[model samples]
Target: MRQGLGTQLRHLIDLLDGAVSAAYDEAGIDYRPRYTPVMRALEGGQPHTVSQIAEAAGITQPAATQTVALMIKEGLLESSPGVRDARQKVVRLSARGRDLLPQLHLCWQATRAAADSLDGDLPYPLSEALAAAIAALQHQPFGARIRKARAAITKETS
Candidate 1:
């Protein structure tokens, strides 16, 4: 049952990712969906340091730094000297990035609508259910124990 659930979850996630990729390609945006969460965090009218972005995006510092570097290179993000720590650069969306917000919204909306249509008459309750599931899973007790057990089983089977 666990394996079946995992497989279904993987399929759904992959399909969603593919949809996002197709939407971005159709919109002529050379960006990745992995960057969306971080970008949306910055779009909340807050300049964030690399560490802050890492925390907010639930990614490692180095991962955030690499993504930020790519965004900077693409002219989607810029950094300025930090207020207290001159060494830490604060990052925010560039003018061009801010301008792309509307287009991004439209593209995402269109993609979401298409996906929903494919699934037949859709409602909003799935989002709430998904959020609850994520919260429950993230806070689940014995998570490490379950993971260790799975690893042990995999090792033994292999």
Candidate 2:
């Protein structure tokens, strides 16, 4: 038995994320790679709801909510009731998060350069391949394929 694509992808992500995490540690920045998306989404200095953050960050609503809660606990983010919706909490960067942006931006640039180098070393760029896969999935989702395969299997068994 060989590892499946999902497992392989997770391994690759762990490797890349570990490298970035080490770099952040070296710089003495208390940040996680998971925080980047939310930080970038709030960079424009506007408070946004968790749903809005999820959309802007290209992540799930639950993931955004969890990240926001963690950031809040870390003193990097603050939240308040949404103006339009009392039940919705709007999130914004705290002073600590704002102060860390300059360092974070430098780290981001360096990380991009490193990723480019890695991509250059590979036979095919991982980022490009991932983008292509995502595009293909958007055109024909995996769920639909799974359903079709199940139907074929049922017909064969019948």
- By TM-score, the best candidate is 2
Residue-level lDDT of model 1, residues 20-128, one tens digit each, is 8887998888778777767877987689999999999888899999999999999989999999989999999999788888888887678678766755655555556
Which stretches in model 2 have alpha-carbon errors above 4 Å? Answer: 153-158
- lDDT scores in order: 0.83, 0.95
Which candidate's lDDT is highest?
2
Find the number of clashing residue pairs for candidate 2: 0
TM-score of 2: 0.93
- Candidate 1 ranges beyond 4 A from true positions: 1-7, 55-63, 112-126, 145-158
